[model samples]
Target chain A: MINNEVTKLLNMTYPVIQAPMAGGVTTSELVAAVADNGGLGMMGAGYMTSSQIREQIREIQQLTEGPFGINLFVPNEFHVSEQEVELASNRLQPIREQLDLQQKEQVDIPNFDKVSESFQQQIEVVIEEKIPFCSFTFGIPSKEIIEELKQHHIILIGTATTVKEAVENEKAGMDMVVVQGCEAGGHRGNFLSGDQESLIGLMALIPQVVDNVSIPVIAAGGIMDGRGLMAALCLGAQCVQMGTAFLNCEESGAHASHKEAILHAAEDETVLTRSFSGKWARGLKNDYINEMHEDESLFPAFPVQNKLSQDIRKAAAAQNKTAFMSLWSGQSPRLAKKQCVESLMEHIISETRKIGRKV
Target chain B: MINNEVTKLLNMTYPVIQAPMAGGVTTSELVAAVADNGGLGMMGAGYMTSSQIREQIREIQQLTEGPFGINLFVPNEFHVSEQEVELASNRLQPIREQLDLQQKEQVDIPNFDKVSESFQQQIEVVIEEKIPFCSFTFGIPSKEIIEELKQHHIILIGTATTVKEAVENEKAGMDMVVVQGCEAGGHRGNFLSGDQESLIGLMALIPQVVDNVSIPVIAAGGIMDGRGLMAALCLGAQCVQMGTAFLNCEESGAHASHKEAILHAAEDETVLTRSFSGKWARGLKNDYINEMHEDESLFPAFPVQNKLSQDIRKAAAAQNKTAFMSLWSGQSPRLAKKQCVESLMEHIISETRKIGRKV
Candidate 1:
């Protein structure tokens, strides 16, 4: 029963994939550990430059002979005025002051053209490196890009938040689709559905997406242990993509304070906020989130707001001040444990087998 | 494998409970059909009078030999000014005109004392009629009422939306707790957690509640079929309480227009709104909800706002206009089917067994 189409396609022992979380969370060590443990490990290359991506692919290759995947953020056209950027940056003056960072008059703003070019370079690196598996988030790639990747014999996965988006991905020639539920951490993968409409839970999302699309469906959200894997399978998902569970692993590059915050958080403590990035993301409640709650809508879109908060997030992390850093976590923080990837993978596999025996 | 503590306590063949969806959805025929099919059928008695409650209990007893349950709404103290009620009522003038209902100068509003008195009498009917099982929503009952029910050998269940609330239910001596997820249709049962915080999905909620409380957790939300039933069990829930799935059953007393809206809906079509009532509820988006979206926070609390919209809802239903009526549904509308309760129960059971053999 464990040997399904997803396992065979991915050439992994289990239908488990470590979700590609952006930023510095997915280190080479973490990806290699997950791959060596017989699960698909995905490098979070959303914010990495082309050279950084090439270097990491080489590093992971040295650590493990097993296959690993890489995820890229599909750049979306964002409109932001210089005045709006300045206003948003000034609004964060107090936070920057609190973190003892200098107030700069000039900030390196990201234009859509530059962002689009960066995404192309990242995709080129993936093709050049011949990564076995590749996934795209935020939005789907163009026909040319998808065809180029397929021509290299690399498996393609698309992230979606609704059935309509899943159908779109299938029509766009994606090999598989990852349906992200509302319980997922980090940035939402909703490109078609509006923010309010896209917040579908896995219980409802999995079955509906499974019925609509013929391709394999991967469930991603608050899944933590073996129970979640079996539950997702029963809901008609062929595989499970976990984020917060792997974010707390020993090899993960997440800040110490971020991991500690998730370890102490309850289910209800995490909330959605667009303050950190123009896009909505779920994280633990902290002083920065609370202080910026009221002005979340006034900030500029995506890469702009994300760039504005870079210095503050960096300074806070360096000083070990979790209250100012973005502590992304899913709703099931209570089930998270600080451990090695090998032990976490073993526990999940064993638990899946145990539940199989009982049910 | 399905005969767990909850099944034994509720004295049912299947660990399925027809959720007590208030406002005339749970008809005696629906309750009896579920009970005859070996699943626990619950009466939605939150809005029923004492006499109505007593009459339905007797009618259900005649139709089915198996045990059934009833649910009550625990009254909370609401503060609203007479001016606030008038303004809220006037805000619905457009909807009332659309429904062809005459707008009244004064709307009869509910007070805390009267709502509390009604709850006490509902409890009296349950005890006097010797109902086998009882559940409470909105919040847990007082200590005296809990002890009184226990003394009569009535199995008590409490509704919770978070781990803290589940722990509170266990401390209050509830035999079992229903952990309602954000994907649930109709009104939210959150009391302790705020609106945003209580929106945890079942993928996160079930496991956390299972770890925190000793009582068996009954998973609610977007669960629709045997896949959901088995998934809940794997998540450590002893049983499942389904609302939207049964709401579409032929035996249910929901308006035909309401059922039809759900049948044509998609997973992302349902949204959470407090426009219909003072409290937040998940339902299909309609003209009425969209009109009141901006002024949602200005309305009075439950029972009061629920009372203010009564005339419009009734007229809309009478005229077959679903736009102004409340069409409650969970996130899994695509899986909904227009069938009898017996077929739903049978399908869920057979599917559970089928999944058990495969997994």
Candidate 2:
């Protein structure tokens, strides 16, 4: 029964899922590699438009016939007040002056319209493409949308931080829940109320969710290798989704500097900060994170704060200045290997088997 | 330089040292086992008398001719007023009644005399016995005592939570520093105060300490297996120290229930709570710790609270009630192997070598 679920998700002999990290880092090649290796490879479409996501999904199909997934960021309308944004923007004026750029007119609410438009269009594409699996992050998609996706026989996985969220996802008729711990990279998926209480890690989160809900649980966060994968399974997770580990793979589209930073990162080098997108996310601690932490007024709410700092981030990336870029990675980034996706998956599978035998 | 320093102190091919856990868990057999495996074995003398410590050390010596160390809990004279203890005791009255105990009486302060007597006597014994290493926790020992111990040419290791503590240890002429992170199992070693700002994990702590001071840095806390060992080494730690990992081994003296609890523990199951020892320590979360957290007034200072609850803890352990026992373990206890010391170390060495190659 376990093998059936595992094989169905990854189209592999073993059930392991490589997390899709969008924004050009998780590439079609990486997705294809995981799919080819008998695990599910997901294409992250957080920053991409519907057309871009379509192209990436089609690109993965071109290389492999195995099952793959597409991950989407559910549009969140929560925004910081106008006063908060101006206060945050004024604090960034010094950096603006330092960058020798003209200060743009003050805008109260940050633009989230782009995100909504992209999400809506991406859903249409998923329907048209008949994507085998789809996952939502940040928050649960609307019931109407979930029903629509279910009608097409799509495997719907919802990201959850707490057991309550997992139960809610199961009640909403989702196929599975990804129990994201505090140790996970990227935006924390605190969709339901009382998300802070849900900051329970994968170790505690997986088993409790498994015991509480009747659905299969997928473990995420801080899982980097076979040992982690095996441990998750032993703790009741049917499969594991790894994001930061694949971020450094040769098939990833992450910047060379970003990959290098991850390879050299110590377990302590990562910190959970909201400096990047005005939402709590884990990344390599650098000057930008440090500055925002020191002066909270410098960071606006998501999309707004995220959009305002987009130019500086791009400039920093172009200049290879990693201290200012969001080098998103998990605590186990140091264990990540610089190898092709197929080899990495093979290594993970073999290692997990060894761990299983030891257990 | 690092290798030589490590070899000289622990008298091992490698400098890895395992932290001593108290309350009868870290046994003489466990110490001897680690020493026999070419790492420093330390007997925790936190709650034992001078004679008991001497006997434990002698027991370890009889088991292995290899070098071993003794760990001491430096006296932390936290002056919680009588009223406070009374208030805390009053809060515990309900539970005390349930256990059929009389109203809590004034438990005398555990004499600091025992600590000094034990230290002075242990120093003489170590010198006479020519023990290779001695480590201190809770706080640094007196400079005069440290200097006296140095005269015996005994290797000294001071535990530190922050870089400042590491620097202070070096300034005090200690041989090495065990960089204990916030994730450490037993009581925290936050000597150089300020709300414990350094919250640094092993990965970040080791490199920063290595960069800041010119001494061998031994990393501790949350390190369980070979990947952790390799990751610490890659971060510039001379070696690694693990307590909870060793506690699950066959040689460990921890209660069978404690061992079972550790084996069954998940990643996020451990939490930092002051409920057990008046001082902050990490252990498997249970009803006692949870209740204490919910009712802050129900806990007294270290030694006092620890002394008062000793009977209850013993009864709980005797009854095989996991919810009432201390259950000390780290976040990665799930990764620990329930095997003999020799086989566990062999697995660690092999796994470490495999991961080391990738780095």
Candidate 3:
């Protein structure tokens, strides 16, 4: 039997959650589509400003009265001195030359102050709007912030890469923890402090997380179908969240080329790289990633590097050259079906039902 | 406690098996090492003849009294008419020009009759020697042959890619079924009749096969450590078989370059291609595979293409050029440790124990 906390929190017949894919792929229409089809839809407010987040929430609220979630990127503000930026920039000189850009240009460093602004503003908006469900990635938020949010009756969910991280999330006052495997696309929610990152994939990560944490776990990464959903549930996850599968739906705001790439991708084509942004993320292999990998020294710090590559990425997307665009997708992107969001959700539910019946 | 049938059938303290990584990587020494460590070590017979298989089995037998298994590839004998070969040859003319080869060279189709001859002689040896376990890949053998092997008290293990294939293996009297997921390296075990090739990964495939078939299932592909081992056990698998992890052990016969490549590989570096042998197989991305993908017409039929590339592969290996070799490995190759086989097995057991303690 399903746990009552999850049942009440998700407001869904099945404990299936659509992962909030930020930066234009997940739209109000997509979220509402899943919500209307009896699964929790998530609005990704990771990159959006407070005003934009509020507007998007209003749009989703108008479409569906059922419960939904909004995902945030818990910012990490590590200071990078100018000397560090210059050193990293010098390493990227070859790439600049390849792009016909002038060398000796001043290296830009991102202001960590922006993180505090984003978090404070987003939290205020969430409190005012009384958003029922909220989830965070990258790292867990402050204990006080979580306490304040919980005071407003908001359910707090945290994302984790390792079992230790999952346990930490539960201890940090999160109502549930999301076990994000290395197979997951986009920025890695690696909160585990270490010399080198430990990547525990979904199959190995889930059961351990379930066993270690006292809280409910929402399994994410590489879950694309009913079989995956059922397997996650059987592995002791209270729910499953999928991003890549939902990214290809018609209601999604992903670019046409991005959708096309997802539809035609093979199983092993996706790769995880820190080239796209300063932090590690998974996406389809492209010339930009290949070039960055070849000239690793030239890349700058995280948010700054991401900002610098914005123009080239925009130009590539406009030109329909997928070879340069960031095609973020998970390992099971090939299993994604290009159907209406509602129909896809229905298919998932039906498949899960079939599996349950057999069991 | 572990199942009695698996222990009795495999002649091991535990039912866990190490996959045979043939083509010299899986050495007699490595097989003996695993058997000595109390796990069933398999010798890959994919590229070997009856004589080579006999020699390897004898070598392993001489080193360890514990049980081991032999893997055979069911020849894909779909006949391409002479005209088809001529047409394929004509299409490959440009590739010949690119290589500066003479234009009108004769193309010889490899004799696939050797597949049956090899298997027949190998079966006689297995029966005479009372080999404890034998597994088939690519597809299952005939019912009469499987029955004959079962009569001799030899365990018959059949590999399957889908639920339908697992059901078929069960009906054909296989003692157990190995669920090979898309995460598996080397040639895909897709039969000609099953046109629908579902790329369900290990996590999704293992449980589905367990639920669909009554026979005990062994999970293969992408499992490198004890965490993977425990997860498979929790998902209802009786045992786990790993290939890539064992490919880098001191006892393995893999070339230095190949071993180094596997050790240096990232989780996302592997890809599946049919360019190597005209059959879909997974390997590390290299110049030869990348070039062939860019020039698809150069690829011919199975054994013919495999034979034609032999000289180039051998030349590349002799010169220690990695770009031309087939570096077949799973996604978890990066996690592979360069240690002795017994120490590696002990490490895996200790890791599993650590995870078990945490749980």
Candidate 4:
């Protein structure tokens, strides 16, 4: 069996990682379960506050005394004009009122002005808790912070949507990099260019990155089973990081209907739409995307648009209506299976071992 | 060395086939060159009349006694209301005048009503000429036509953009099916479902098709060179049909500027746009797609819009301007090379063999 290089770095038996899915998807239970199964489990700490991150870390430690990682989003400081945000908010008001979603109290969208303060606090917690693994997405982290993390013996990983980002990550001394393909779900981790321009699929991404950089490479996007694992290895990946595969797992934090939507998604049904969030994310087509897609100029840049749609998405999920929910999934969600994390891990490992020898 | 199944079936040395590209790209020289190199070459006859097909067949026969295939576009009959056609015409008036392309005499757009007559004439030419191999795309051909070709000892292949379409091809008695992933360039092979819903990528397509159908599967889309050839083999495809890789070949009929565009296209530059043609096609982003994309409602269905934009496309190509041309490409244009067809074929075969042994 090929004991991939990333497994040694992540302190895992199998070269498989449960992709950290932000926006209320990955939970402490899910992370603990994945780690307990002898794979790298990660907390999606990008959307969490310092307190929430601390609580989740302790809860994960309580459930499983195994190594795990936390994923954070690098700061992308950009502002949507007040006129644009106001226009976007006004346009979404009809959808919000029609769904009667305003009644529910909402969590504040993270303010970009205070983003650095919160991010610093979160990084401090990772150091204080002696977190062993940490990954960042969206953009390259500052060199000083990376060195600080390295001093604490933290194995740093970076998410890249393009080869340039991967090279930058390597220059920043990341131990590894997750190459997120265009087929990946959620917001793209593009920094050097427009996320749309960085749509390099994993099949083309892995080998090129391997050829250019010395660091271990992790493949992500549309990887759902052992076949995907074997293919990624064939493409020269050190490991495979899968998010869509675990979306339906029993320990996953996905709402029942969100999980159902993922289970029922067809291979080609999910599309990159900015209607749900200001940033491009792959999700199953819903009325929200269709209705607001006519005039994309009406939507503000991400975070603002992501924030405005949050309440409607929450309401859609609460009522089990997919009409407005951001059913984030990879391109091949049809391959998803509902099982426990352990069972999913077992099948992937066995299948890879079975097929890995033949190739 | 792995002797791929399609190679044995087609009496070729390598499991590579030149994808038949219509619209003035694939030439008799390219086809003969590929066949001469021990790879299967295909004549794209979907855009040619019976006499043109006969002349090209004779030209190919003279150049290489080795077998080559002819690809036809299955007649998809649908009436476009005159109003829709007029709206499409009106929308292009501004683009047409801006490019000063009105000097060229326009060929009458094929009347959908007379489609069967022309298709019948083409098939009759195929039969009378005793063509050895034939393939169909766009939709399923009639049983009588397939039976007729089979009686002539012609090996038949059908194009499918999804597994369901692949199964349908098998049921219709095609010898094999080309499983086209969304990553493929040119016009999509979608018929059963809307092309948008048929955007399944190659990584997810090849394995599922191989599992579901007993017939040999020829994988297409995003396959650039020998590494792609090896990957398709690992995915259980019997062979690969690559179009983008050959777009820049010296023997190809693509304009020099088109070749340059394909060579320079970024990973995410190509997108599915119906602006050029009524049907969704992947190509480099140009002004035609960008300006016309906003009011796609003003466009008519395939062949019509495909025909309407011909003058503008021709003008743009003549001027060496990318703003109005359809630089058809896939997601991996960065891997394309500008070489003679013979050199490209040699490189691909050698690379596949080298990588195939290692994998």
- 1 or 3, which is superior by lDDT? 1
Q: Which candidate wins on lDDT? A: 1
- What tens digits encode model 4's per-residue C-alpha lDDT throughout B245-290? 8778999899888899887766667877888877788888888888
Relative to the unseen true structure, what is the C-alpha lDDT of residue A305 in candidate 1, on a scale of 0 to 100? 95
TM-score for each candidate, following the candidate numbering: 0.99, 0.64, 0.61, 0.90
Model 1 regions more than 4 Å off: none
lDDT of candidates 1 onward, in order: 0.93, 0.74, 0.74, 0.82
Better of 1 and 4 by DockQ: 1
DockQ for every model comes to 0.86, 0.08, 0.06, 0.34
- Residue B177, candidate 4: C-alpha displacement in angstroms: 2.0
> How would the candidate models be sorted by TM-score, starting from the highest?
1, 4, 2, 3
lDDT of 3 at A272: 63
What are the C-alpha RMSDs, in order, of all predicted structures? 0.9, 8.5, 11.7, 3.2
Q: Is candidate 1 or candidate 2 better by DockQ?
A: 1
Candidate 1: true interface contacts recovered: 0.83
What lDDT does model 2 reach? 0.74
Name the runs in model 4 displaced over 4 angstroms. A80-109, A167-173, A207-214, A287-300, A315-318, A322-324, B80-106, B287-297, B315-324, B353-358
- Give chain B TM-scores in order: 0.99, 0.93, 0.91, 0.96
Docking class of 2: incorrect
Model 3, span A1-359: residue lDDT tens: 23345766768877778898878877899888888887888988887889999998999999988778899988777666676666666655554555555664453455778777788899889989989889998888888899899999998999987666887898899999888866677777886643123344566456657667899999887777776766566555778888888888899888888889978875456766777667778788777778787645455556766766665566667777787778998766657678888888888777765644544
